[model samples]
Target: MPDRAPQPVDRQLPTDEARDLIALVRDIVQREIAPRAAEEEEAGLFPREVFRLLSGSGLLALPYASEHGGGDQPYEVYLQVLEELAAARLTVGLGVSVHSLSCHALAGYGTKEQRAEHLPAMLGGGLLGAYCLSEPASGSDAASLRTKAVRDGDDWVLTGTKAWITHGPVADFLTVLARTGGEGARGITAFLVPGDAPGLSAAVPEKKMGMKGSPTAQLHFDGVRVPDSRRIGDEGQGFAIALSALDSGRLGIAACAVGVAQAALDQAVAYATDRTQFGRPIADFQGLRFMLADMATRIEAGRSLYLTAARLRDQGKPFSRQAAMAKLFCTDAAMGVTTDAVQVLGGYGYTQDFPVERYMREAKVLQIVEGTNQIQRMVIARHLAGPETR
Candidate 1:
C-alpha cells in the first residue's frame, strides 16, 4: 500500500508562531520527505539533500540562539517540530536531534569568538554534524571513554575511535570528547573538530535492522590535529558537557519516540477501519477497538510526558530527572505501540508491504539510544532516591 500522510496532531502550542512553524514543517514533510522515506530507507540511502533543504529552511536550528543563525524557539516548540518530522520519517527526525546534540557543546560553552566563528555555518550553512562520545569499549559508561588528546603547543593531537556515531561518515564537523587527564569524567574535554580533518576516517556503516537510511559508523582519529581554539570548554569539562547535552538529547529522543508511536498508531487506525472481516469492517469489533483505543492513549500519554519535560527545560529549571522519565516512558511506549500496530494489521504487518513492521524495528533503537531505557531508570532513581551506593 502507498504511504498515507499522517493525521495532523492537535497541539496546544504556546504561540501563533509555534503553530505556524509546525504547519510549515508538516508541509515540507508531506511535499518533500514522506513520499521517499520508505524507498530510501529500504535502499539504505541517506537523504543528504533533505537535510540541506532543512538547513536552508531554518528547520535544523530551531532551538538555539537567533544571533547565530538559529530560530531561538523554545524547547517545547522545537520538540513538536521533531515529532512532525519523525512521524514522517525516523531518519530525518533523529538526524535533526543528533545534529542539534552535536552543536550543543560549542553553542553552550564556547567563547563569544568561537560562537561567532562557527555557529552560523553549523546552524544554517547546511553543514552536517556528528557527536563523538561513545568508544568501542565505552557505550553507556561514557565517562570512561579512552580516546586521548595530547597537547602539542598550539594544537592537540587526538587518537582514538568513536563508535556508533550518527552521520559519522557524512558529517561536516564533529563534537569530540577525549581524555586529557586522568581516568573518569573529570579527565575528559570537548572539542569541535572539522569532519574532514586529516587522519579522521570512518569505518563502514553498520548494517542495522532499521533506520538504515541513517549511517551509523565508527570514526577513527589517528593523530587528528585540532587547534587549541577548538576546545569547547575547560580541560576536564568534556564529560560534564556531554552529560548536559544528553539531558536535552534524551528529550529529543522522547519526542522522536512519540512521533514514531503516533505514526504507527495512525497506520493502525487506518488499517483497522478499512480492513474487513466476516463481511464487516474490523472497526465494528470490540477487541480491535479496545486495542486501537489503548494505542492512542499511550501515544497521548507519551506526548504529554515529553512535553511536560520540555516545558521544565524551557523555563530554565533543572529538568534532568524529568527528561530521563520522558525518555524511558516514551520509548517503551513506542516499542509497545508499534508492536500493537503490527498486530492490528494481522499477517500484512509481518510483511514489508506495510510500514508498521518497519516502525516496529525503528522503535527498538529509540529505547537503546541516547541512553538505554535501563540507564534512564538509574538516572530517574538517582533523582528520586539518590544515587546507588557502591
Candidate 2:
C-alpha cells in the first residue's frame, strides 16, 4: 500500500490553541507533506518550499517569545508538533529542529538589540538556518574544534571548515561556534553569520544512509568577516552556548525518534493484521502480538520521557540530564522498534517498497546526531557522578 495518513496521535494539549495548531499540522501533513515524502526522499530532493510554507503558516517558530514573531508555545507543545511532523517525514521534522538549533545562540544569548533586530526575521520570515560546531577532527570532542575566529578592527574574521552541517548547502543563516581564546572550551565564542557572507561556502552534501532529503555537508568559512555586532554571546561563551543549545536539541531529536518509531509501528501493525500465515493473520500469532506490544510500549515510554524533559525546560529548571536520557532511550527505542517492525513484516519489510526499512535506516542517524548514544551516556553520568578525570 502507499503511505497512509499520519497515524492519529492522542495528544494532551494544555490549551485550545495548541489543539488547533496540531490540527493544522495534521492537515498540512496529510495534504502537503506526507504524499511526497517517500518519493522525494528517494530522489534526494530537499523540499525547500515546504519550509517556506511552514514559515508562512506560523508553524516554524512555536517555542520562542511571541515578541519576536514566535508562537510562544511551551516546549511541551513544541515537541509534540515535532513528533507529529517527524511521523510524516524525518527530514522535515529533524530539519525544523536543526533550524531551531541554528537559532538558539541568538534567541538565548544574543543582546536585546540583536534579538529585536534579527529574531523576527529568523523566527517567521521564511528563512532557514544551520548550526556549525563540529569539524572533521572534532565531532564528540567539540571543544577540540579548530575553527578559529580572529579579532580585527570591529570585526571577527572566521576561517575553518565545519563538517556534518545540516542544511549547509542551502541555509539562509548560520549560528557558528569558533575558537577565539586558548585551546579548550573557554576559548570559544558564538557568532551569527548571514549565508550570503563573502568567503563562506558549503561543500557538496554527503551521501547518507537516510534522510537524504536533508543536506549534510562541510561548510567552509574562509576569512568570513562578521561585524562585532553579530557576535552572539561574549568571547569565551560559545562552548556553553553550544552545550545549552544541545541540551534542548537532544530533546528535539528524542521526539523525532519517537515519531519515526510510531510511524514504523503503525506500518507494522497494518501489515501484520492483513498478512496471514498458518491460515490466520500474522498479528493473531502470539509472537507477532508480543512484538507489537513491545514496540508500542517503547514508543509510549519514549514520548513520556521526552515530554517530561520538555516540561522541566518550560518550567525554567535544569534538564540537561533528562534531555540526555531522553535522547539515548528514545533513539535506541526507535532503532530497535524499527528493526523489529521490519521483522514483523517478514520478507516484505526488507524491501524498499515498504517504509519500515526506511524507518530502520532513519533511526540509525538519530542515535548519532545531536550527540551519539555514548556521548549521551557520558553526559548523564556526569550529572550523576561528576566530570571524568583527565
Candidate 3:
C-alpha cells in the first residue's frame, strides 16, 4: 500500500498456527509477489513458478484434509491467506481460489477411490487447475451450458467451448461441466479432464481491464475423450456440483475483494498522511479523513461478512445465501474503495506511478466473476422469498 512493503493485516486469526501461517504468507508475498506484481501484470505474464513455490510451501492446500497432503486448515484460515496474497497481487490470490474450485468436485463428491487416486497430487502437487462452467451462451444460467459429453465404450467424448475460464490456457487439469442428458439442469454432469487431453485446446487469452497476468480464455473440447473414471460425480449431477463449488468459490472471491479493498485503503491512507495540502497534510482535512474512515469501515465490514460465511461453512451449516451476500457486498466494496483510493491520490493515482489505479481496475472484475452482483441479489432474494411462483 505504501509502495514499501505494507505491514501485516492485524488479523484475529483463530489459532496460533493460523497466525504463523499468515506470517509465512506475508513473508512470501513481500519476497516473491509484491515486488514483481506491477511489472509482470503489465506484461501479462503468468507466474507459474510462483505457483510452484506456493505448492512446495504447503500454501496451496490449506483448506483440505492433512491426511491427503492438504494443510487441513479450516476455511477461515484458508481465506485470510488468500487475502494476504491478494493484497500483493490479485492474480495469485484468485489463481489459488480457482485451483481450489477445480479440486472441489473430487474432494467433496468423488468416489473414495477417485479421491485416493487424485486428491493428494491436486492438493499439493504443484499442479495448476481451472474450473469450466461459464460458456459463450450461458453465464449466470450455468445449467444452460451446451457442452456435450456423449458416452461411448466406457469413455465420454466432450465437445463444446467453456468461456471466461481462469487459467484456461495453462491449467494442468480442469473440472468441466458438460451436458450429458436431456435439456436443463438435470442433464448436466462434471468431469475431471486433463488439460493435455487430445482435442482440448485454449483460445488466446482475452484482453481485459484487470488481472491481465491471470489468463482468461475459452477452452475448446473438440471431441476430447475422457475416461469414465475421470467423471467427478454421477451423470446429470454436474449443475448441482457446479453450484456447490461456486458456493465456496464465491467466498474466495469475497476474501479477495477485501484484500484488494484493504490494499487500496492502505495506499490511500499512506498517500493522505504524506502529501501536503494548502498548509498541512490532506489527512488533517475533514473531508479526506471522512473518506479514509469510510474506506476503512467498509473494508472491515467486508472482512467480517466473508469470515462469518466462512465460519458457517466450516461448521457444516447451510451457507449458500450468506456466501452470495458476502460476494456481493465485499466485491462491491472493493470497487468503491479502490475508486476512492484513486480519488485520494488524484492525478498521481491516475498514473502508473502508483498502484491504486491498477487496484481500481482489478476490483471491477470481482463484481462480475463468481456471480454478478445482480445474480447474487437473485440468489439472496430466492432464499428469502422461497423461489418464484409460476
Candidate 4:
C-alpha cells in the first residue's frame, strides 16, 4: 500500500497569530518539505533551498526580538513550529534549532551596534549559521575546551578545531567559544567569526548513522582573526553564554524528539490499521493496541514536557532543570517509540522500505546531543540536591 501522509497534530496555540504561523508552516512542510524528505535523505542531498525558504518566510528567527528582524514569537510558539518541521523532516527542524543556537550569543549579549550590524543579516537574510563549542577533546567537560584565542592589537586570533559541528561545512557564520585566560570555565570567551575567515576551514562531513542530508563536520580555526567588535558578552564569559544557549537548545531537542516519536507513532498506527493478521486488522489485536496506546501516551507526554519547559522560559522563569528533564525523557521516549514502531511493522520495519528504521536511528542522536542524557541526569541531580562531590 502507498504511504499516507501523517495527519496534522491537534495543537493548543496561544494566539491567532501563532495558529496562523503554524498553519503556514504546515502548508510549507506538506507542499515543499515532506515530499522530498525521503528521496533527498536517501541521496544524501542537503536541502539548502528549504532553509532559504524558511528564512524568507520569517520562520528561521522566531524566538528573538522583532526589532532585530526576528519573528519575536515566544519560546512556546517557536518550539511548536520546531515540532511541526521535525515531524516532516528532522534535518530541517534540527537545522533551524542549531542556527538559532548559533545566533543566541549575539542576539542576547552583543553590543547594540553589533546587533544592528549583524542580527538582521543572521535572522532573516538567508544566511546559515553554526555554533562551535565542542571539540575533539571536550564534549561533556565543555569547560575543558582547548581552543585558544589570543588578543592581538585589535583582533583576536583563534586557533584549534571544533568537532561535531552541525552545518559546519555550509555555515555562513559561526558563534565560537575559545579559551582566553588561564585554565577552566571562566577563562573561555565567545566570538562571532565569519565562516569564510581566511584561516578557517571545514573538514569532510562525518559519515553518520542517519540524518545523512545534514552535515556534521569538524571546523579548523587555524589562527583565524576575529575583530574585537564581534566579541559577545564580556571577556571570559563564553562558558556561561554556551550554557544559556544549551538550556534553551535542550528544549529544541525535546520538541524534535516528540516530533520524531509522533511521526513514528503515526506510521505505526497507519500500518497496523491496514495490515491484517489472523483475518483481522492487527490494530484490532489487544497486544498491538496496547503497544499503540503506549506509543501515543509517551509521545503526548514528551510534547507536554517540552512545552512546559518552553512556557516557563517564555514567562522568564528559570527552566534549566526542566529543560534537562524534558531533553532526557523525550529523547529516551523517542528512541523507545521509534523502536516500537519498527516492531509494529514486523519484518518490513527493519528495511529502508520503511521510515521507522530511519526514525529509530535519528532518534538515537537526540539522546546524545545538546547534552548527553547522562549529563542531563547530573544537571537535574544538581538542581534537586547539590553538586556532585569529587
Candidate 5:
C-alpha cells in the first residue's frame, strides 16, 4: 500500500517543536505499538511493555510540568501523541489518558508537599493510575455518588464501591472521590488511595465489547484507610477537581477517536483500491469514492476540533465546552468512519482477521466513557446557554 496521504495542515497548527514531537510519537506508534496491538487484544492482556516504552520515551509526562521530571509539552502536542498511539492501539491510548487524568488532581490541586512526594513516581515511572469517580448509580451524575470517607484521627476511612473503573485491577494508585462533608458535589473529597491498601479490592475484570486489553472492573473500598495527607485539595474540592481533570481528559479521548477514524479511513482506502469489482477497483466507482471522501473529511474535521480544543487548553482559556464538543463529535465520527470501513471491506471486514472490525468495536466505548456523548451534549448546551442559565 502507498503511504497514506499527509494530514491536512490547519492555519492554527502547532509550532516546529510540537510538530517534531508529533512526528516522533507517530513513528513510535507505527513501529512499536501497531505490531503488538492485535495479539495483546486477542490475549486480553494490558500492554505493560508498551507503557514501559512510553515512560522511557518520556511520552507519559507530555502534558505535565518539566520541573517534575515531565516533558511539559503543551496539550496541543500531547494530544496528537495520544491520537497516534490510539491509531495503533486504543488500549494503550486510553490507559495513558486515564493515567494522565489520575495525575491531574495532584498536579492541579495537591499541596506543595504532596507534589514533591508523589509527582516524581507518577511522572517518571511505568506505573499506571486509575481515577475513581463513577459508581453504579452515579456515572453521568457523578456528584451524587454515595461513597463515604470518614475522618479518623490522622487518616480517613473510605467505604464504597466505584464501578466501571478503568485499570481497576492493575493500577498502582487510585485517585478516589468520596463524600466527606454534606451531600451533593460539595461534600466530596479526592483521596490518593494506594492500590494495595487494606480493604481495597477489585472485582473480576469485565468482559467488554471493545478496548478489551484495557481492563474495566469495580473497585471495592471497604474501610480503606488513607492518610489525611493524601487528600487532594480542600475537603469540598473533589467534584471541581474531577470536573477540571475531565475537561482535559475529554480532549485526549477526542484525539484518540480521531486517530481511530483516521486508521479506519486508511484501511478502507487501501481495501477499496485492492478489491476488484466490475473488472476495476471499487475505489474507481464514484459512489464508493464519495463515501471515502466523506470519511476522510470527517476525520480531518474531527482532528481540527480536538486540536483547537487542545490549543485553547494550552492558552489557559475556557476549554470545557470545546473539549466536550470535540469528544462528542470525534467519537461519533469515529463510529461512522469505522462502520463505513467495515462496509467497504464487506464480509472480510466483519471478521477478526481484519483490524477495521476491531476498530469498529473499539469506537463504541469512546462514546460512553469519559462521560457519555449524551452528557457531553448537555455540557456543551449548558456552556452555550451561559452560567446564569445553567
Candidate 6:
C-alpha cells in the first residue's frame, strides 16, 4: 500500500502558515478525534480526554495572544483548524468554539491583571468554558434578559437562569451577562464567574437531538458572589461585549458548518465508490455523481465565505455582516449537503451504521445555535440596508 500514498495537500489559501496549520489539524483529527467520535456520541459522554489532547497539541489556544501560552495564529488560520476538528467530531469542535467564546470577554475587555489571572487557565488548562447570555425568555432579544447582578459592598451577587448553555455542566468558567442597572442593553454588564462559585448550579443536561456528547444545560445562578474585580468591563458594557464576541463566534460556527458538510460529502463519496448497485459503483452513475459534485462545490463556497470573514477580522475591518452571511450560508449548506448525503446512501444513510445520518442530525444545531440562521439573515440584511434603514 506504500503508506496509502500521501494525500494531496490543499493549495495554500493566501498564506502558507494557514495551509500548514490546516494540514496539521487534519492529521491530528483523522488520527485521534474521529476514531472515538461515534463511541462518545453514542454514550452521550463528554470528551474530556479529547480536550486534553487538543490543549496539548496547542489547538485550543490558537487564536489567543502568544503571551498566554497561545499559538498566536490569525483568525483565518484558527478557523480552518476548527473546520478540521468539526469534520471529525461536532461535539468537540462546538465545545472548542464555545470555550473560545467564553474567553473572548477576558481577551478583549479584561484589564492586564484580569487577563493575567484568567487567560493562562482558560487557554492552557484543559478546562472548557460556557457563555451565559441567552435566557429562557430572551434568546434573540438578549438585551431584555432579566438576570441581575447587584452590588454588595465589595462584591457582586448574581441571580438568574441561563438557558441553552453549551458546556454548562462541565465548564470551568462562565462569561455571564446580567442586568446591573435599569432595563435595556445599556443596563447589562458582563461577569466572569467560576463554575464552582458557591451558589452556581447546572441543571440536568438537555437531551438534545444532536451534539449529545457536548452537554448543554441550564445554568442557575442563585446569589453567586464574586469580587468586583471579576467584572470584564465597565458597567453597561456587557451587551456590547456579548455582541462583539458573537461576531467572532459566528465565524467559528460557520467553519463548523463547512466541516460538517465536508464530512458528509467525504463519507458519501467513499460509500458511493465502495458500494455497488446494478453491478457498478454508484459513484459511476451520473445522477449520484452530480449530487456529489454539488455537495463539494457548496462546501468549498462555505469555506471561502468563512475565510473571507476571518481575513476581514485580521485586517481590523468591520465584519459582523460578513460573519453573519457566512454563518447563515454555511449552516444552511451543511443541512442541505447532509440531507442529500443521506439520500445518496439510501437505506444505509438512515442508520447509525453510517456517519451521514449522524451528520444530518448534527447539522441541524449549527443552523439554530450561534444566533439561528434567521437572526443571521436579519444581521446581514441590516448591514445591506445601511445605517439609516437599520
Q: lDDT tens digits, residues 1-390, model 1?
A: 456677899999999999899999999999989988888889999999999999999998999999999999999999999999999999999999999999999999999999999999999999999999999999988888999999999999999999999999999999999999998899999999999999999999999999999999999999999999999999999999999999999999999999999999999988888998999989889999999999899889989999999999999999999999999999999999999999999999999899999999999999999899999999998988997998
| Candidate 4 runs further than 4 Å off | 1-4
Give, for candidate 1, the lowest lDDT window spanning 10 residues. 1-10
* lDDT value, residue 287 of candidate 1: 94
lDDT scores in order: 0.95, 0.95, 0.93, 0.93, 0.88, 0.88
Question: Which residue pairs overlap in candidate 1's backbone?
Answer: none
Candidate 2 per-residue lDDT over residues 239-289, each given as its tens digit: 999999999999999999999999999999999999988899989989889
TM-score of each predicted structure versus truth = 0.99, 0.99, 0.99, 0.99, 0.95, 0.95
lDDT (10s digit) by residue, model 3, range 1-390: 224455578789889999888888888898999989988998899999999999999988989888788998999999998998898899999999999999999999999899999988988999989999999999988888999999999999999999999999999999999999999999999999998999999999999999999999999999999999999889899899999999999999999999999988988998899999899999999999999999999999999999999999999999999999999999999999999999999999999889999999999999999899999999999999988788
lDDT per residue, candidate 4, 1-390, as tens digits? 223345799999999999999999989988888888888887889999999999999999999999999998999999999998988888999999999999999998899999999999999999999999999999999999999999998999999999999999999999999999999999999999998999999999999998999999999999899989989999999999999999999999999999889999999998899998889999999999999999999999989999999999999999999999999999999999999999999999998888888899999999999899999999999999999788
Regions more than 4 Å wrong, model 6: 1-20, 387-390
Off by over 4 Å in 3: 1-3
With candidate 6 superimposed using the best TM-score fit, by how many Å does residue 322's alpha carbon deviate from the native?
Answer: 0.3
Q: List the lowest-lDDT window of 10 residues for candidate 6.
A: 1-10
Local error of candidate 5 at residue 323 (angstroms): 0.7
Model 5 regions more than 4 Å off:
1-16, 386-390
What digit string (tens of lDDT, one per residue) describes model 6 on residues 1-390?
000111232644557766777777778776777777887788898988888888877888989998987888889888877777888888978888998999999999999999998899889888778999999999988899999999999899999899999989888889999999998999999999999999999999999888889899999999999899999999999999999999999999999998888888888887899999899999999999999999989988998899999999999999999999999999999999999999998998898888788889999999999798988888887788754442
C-alpha lDDT of residue 128 in model 6: 78
- Candidate 3's displacement at residue 366, Å, is 0.3
Cα TM-score of candidate 4: 0.99
Model 1: residues >4 Å from true position, as ranges?
none
Better of 1 and 6 by TM-score: 1
Reference-based lDDT, residue 284, model 4: 98
